[model samples]
Target: MPIQASFPSQEPLGLNADLIRKYNQPAPRYTSYPTALKFKPIEDKASRSAMLADIEDAEGPLSLYVHVPYCRSLCWFCGCAKIISTNTALADKYLDYLEMEVRRYANLIRSGRKVVQLHFGGGSPNFLSPAQIGRLDNILRSSFEFDPSAEISVELDPRTLSKSQVLAFRKLGVNRASIGVQDINSKVQEAIHRIQPTETNIKTISWLREAGINSINVDLIYGLPHQTESSFNQTLDEVLGYDPNRLAVFSYAHVPWSKPAQKILERSPLPTADSKIDILIQTVQRLTGSGYAHVGMDHFAKIDDPMVKAQEAKTLQRNFQGYSLHADVEICAFGMSAISQSKNSFRQNQKDLDAYYKMLDEGDIPLEKGYLLTPDDQIRREVIMRLMCDLELDFQARGESNGVDFQNYFSSELDRLQVFEEDGLISFVEGGLEVTPLGRLLIRNVASRFDAYLGDAKQGFSKAI
Candidate 1:
């Protein structure tokens, strides 16, 4: 059965210079409260042990994030940490090291926490063969007690998928597949060097459906070179024809200075700020008109989708994967450059594969950087998360619930948001601040108002849009 869309379009919204000026500022994605850049390098075994002990003491089920950094080819627009390789031996060796780290963490947390959610993100998880995926699944099961109904999901590169591989994913307990389809325009595809045809995507979608895996997500990107309002509309039309359960419409973050491959793309041809805003407004209108419920920033879903339900119930959570079903679970991330968040702290694995392998070879849990959150960090995190997830925050309610005086703790931050209140971006009511309809487009900016580390001169985050 097709899921009904939830967003309704009334009038086509225009992007004026003032709107562009207001929204054209840099901001973090807020995947974590402090963000990964704030994490300091772990000094010794004691710090690492303390982090592991915290994870061991967590009260509920855990979430696992495994990063597979290998990719068959590079997409110029991508800023992800990935290694391009066709060598099977390299993958085999990487898996060995990954298993070692998994075992090391398992031993540290001896109670064997049950995994409630397991996500495989990548360079491309599909870069591994079906057999390799199965073997990796075995490794996880061997080390942890996976809940029978755990949401096991994987990010797939459609260009590399095979029919057998699709079946193998299901057999290996993958219940969700997120496929990347940046644009269907051939010219745009060529410009980005990611020439995925619509036929391939449709076939993969059909196969996954036939395999009884209905939780399909399609990722689309706007603001790429050669992308125009017409081109994007066409892409959206084709995407809507597929009718995915979830849609992630990301704005392209072109940071050629940071990500060298991005230099391959000609900067001049990329859309202007006004042009980008036009595409975004049009895309949002189209999705909403098609009955897709706006599931906050960069995401939309059918009314019946679990994410939509979560949003309505005010239980939606934002994580590295974007919006998630399991937010409260302690995230245990494995592989190079992965990050795990416990209740009180954040821990990250080694970024370089060589460094990661070296640590595991020496029987150490290759953690590179981390932060132990203070009580203030927790309070600010709660406020920021509420704004990001629910677009509202109850100051007094939070204070009462968490036993922290909201005004005393965040008095300066609240004062900072007064301008937004004046601009009608937010509402200051009796006990809380709620984002207005216009504020939804500036959620990241609004959330950043509460981030203590965001205003530093050294911060190099992307634009909030």
Candidate 2:
């Protein structure tokens, strides 16, 4: 179909294959302004200490992320930095280092700052035994200050998850869970090298709810090898039947250059580009048509979900963990390959396990690369994040916030966006801009317009379809 540039912005998102192909180009995910691609090497240990000391006096509650970099097996589609291991001994050892790192931060971060959010992301947190899970939780609770009602969430690989582990997570104050359910089709699972049975996901979710941790989110990936429109719809059907509170249906990010394991999929007959976009369009129709709000860029949530509430109130935030409720808090991360975010800086821990363990072994911070946002970077960040999360921007009002003449400052960018406006992706209002429903799917492309570093250096990013 040809583009429909004249559609009313209030109309529900409509499929335009022309628009999909036109906007489907590589772009940074913008999980952070300037993105991780722009991060630079850290100078010294004092810079690390200074980062922590800086956090001591910062405003707002703290958000903590724990990275367990060991997975029982490699999932070909995974882009996360993870080690494939079954050694309980390795996790136990890693936990010791993780605790040391956490304690180091705890000592630096004053007790007055309460932790508002805690997340466990992984190779798979489910890879840990029940005791290890408890031990990791105890280390954090004993070291850091936590709000009683904080949202504690964990990412679980259903294939490795157990009822005991879920119970242990509940006991440790985990209230939310994200289970991987990429596809239920046998051929699709075999193609991706993540042979998860549908029953595994079903059983795991049931265990989480039985343990009273009811807020469950399931992740699905479209455009995988051997996947089809009908197969994916069936996968969606099964997942929706799981009755998840929120869902993230991501386009399979095929960055085989960085994650060499993904090369395995090249041997399989993958869906053609046209077929994939058809699946994407149908997915939006099925999800939104089923009453789930298209919660920006591949995420969907029920009408009453907290994420929907946050987006409606314009308090939703996009971070390394995807969309989050906390807006202004500093995110401090633990373990190797974890990235932490503060008001002005982004820092990632050492990605190599040996180096990561070495740093903590010597009582040093495991920082590898960091970036401090410049004033211009900050302004662009605000504009881009507003577009990505809030789905709109008030130029005159936001101009006052950034102390710039919005139209004059972004004049060039505005001129560049004429194509989007013409394509009906964005609409100009009286003194601001509103991203139309169709634009939300391509918000990364829309937001990348404000990125000062986005020109010709977008290496390792997935296409924006």
Q: Top model by lDDT, which number?
A: 2
lDDT of 1 by residue, 1-465 (tens): 111222333333332447546866888888889888789999977887788788777777888999999999999999898999887568888898888988878876648568888899989988888888888988898999989999989999999998888888899888888999999999999989998988999999998999988999999999898999999999999999999998999989888899988888884389888888888878777887786777777888877788777766666788887888866788889999999888899998888989999988887888899998988788777778767877778777778756978788788988999998877677887678777655666788889888888775435887866
TM-scores, one per candidate? 0.94, 0.95
Estimate the lDDT of model 1: 0.83
Candidate 2 accuracy as TM-score = 0.95
Query: lDDT of model 1 at residue 130?
Result: 80
For model 2, where is the 10-residue window of minimal lDDT? Answer: 1-10
List ranges where model 2 is wrong by over 4 Å. Answer: 1-11, 45-53
Candidate 1 TM-score, true structure as reference: 0.94
